[model samples]
Target: MSRFLLSASRLLALLLCAVLLSACVQDLTGPDDPDDPPPPPVRMRTVYDLKVSPRYIDVVGSCDKVFGSPTAGEFQYRVEVNGEGRTNGFESQNYNSRLGVVTGRVAGQQITFAPRTYTWSSMSSPGRIEAVVFGTEWDGAIRDGDMSNRRGARTVPFALGRRPGTVTIGATSECRLVLAYEAEWVQREVPA
Candidate 1:
């Protein structure tokens, strides 16, 4: 009977020690200190639809033979914009077919598409051929839920050539397409 009491007392003492130790521990994910600054509010995404019309199209270099002159035309596309604090970005599928997702930053009311580079390589019997495309500048603005007389340009410099033996042959050319556009607020989308 005495041994049983001693065992029970030992178990009780162990549990008390555990409880006291747990109380001394601090929660790592607790709320921030009262003196610390509050977190910034989350920014919502916005979408806009625009009708872009080509005002001018210019092709330079010997590669003009490959890409003929394009006539002025208008096309409709959508743009999705996401903003974080001071930095913001927008994505558009109609920007470039070769690029899956185009990202751009927002400054005031203007949005600019970031430059990008694309490369392609192919193996042939005699040698290998490589092609590189460089993305230029594109930007516009929105005011009062509408964009009017927004001007932007898309410049692509393409280089294609073949490396045969120790010599390389290729053609380099650039296409500059300038556009003016008007956009309307289609709708706002918040992530689920």
Candidate 2:
């Protein structure tokens, strides 16, 4: 009986030491310490269409005199959007007409514009796309580093908010430009 008890005690002690060793190994091989990952992608939608007709009531001369070009013989509308570091152009028109269409994602939430203190310009010309709200019943213009254009095609930079929520970005040029956008958020796990 004494010999049997001695063997049992030794076995229990061995098991306890094994359990402690296993825990120590796990702590050493755990997940790496790093910054938190980015949030998931969200669904966006255009709830209100920023369609507004230009009255051309506030500018000097005729609507053509203020907005249209004598050489082109038509109004030039240049549209540009800042895609962070990359600027994407929608389309340009050379006739006296309304602005282009801006659509959001499938679902809805307003777009957030994170204002950055820097100058953004077009690669093709010296003209730059200024960060100003358009679509109002007012005339937008160019000043210094600011950009403005009539109904002409152009490329400009735009900023998007870091999180999924209501974001409103003003028109890039000087004119009556209005844009409405909305978005829906979804959780996604980005791979490390």
Minimal lDDT window, size 10, model 1 = 161-170
Q: After superposing candidate 2 on the true structure, give the runs of residues whose Cα lies further than 4 Å from its correct spot.
A: 1-76, 94-175, 182-187
Per-residue lDDT of 1-192 in model 2, one digit per residue for the tens? 989999999999999999998887866567765676667766543221111111111111111122344111112323233433545333323212335332221112222233322333222222333222221121222111221332222222222322211112223323223332222122222323
Q: Count the backbone clashes (under 3 Å) in each candidate.
A: 0, 27
| lDDT tens per residue, model 1, 107-190 | 112223443222221211112221211223222221111111123322211222221111111122222222222212223345
lDDT (C-alpha, whole model) for all candidates = 0.30, 0.30
Task: In angstroms, give how far residue 123 of model 1 lies from its true place.
Answer: 44
Candidate 1 segments exceeding 4 Å error: 28-30, 42-48, 52-192
> What TM-scores do the predictions have?
0.22, 0.22
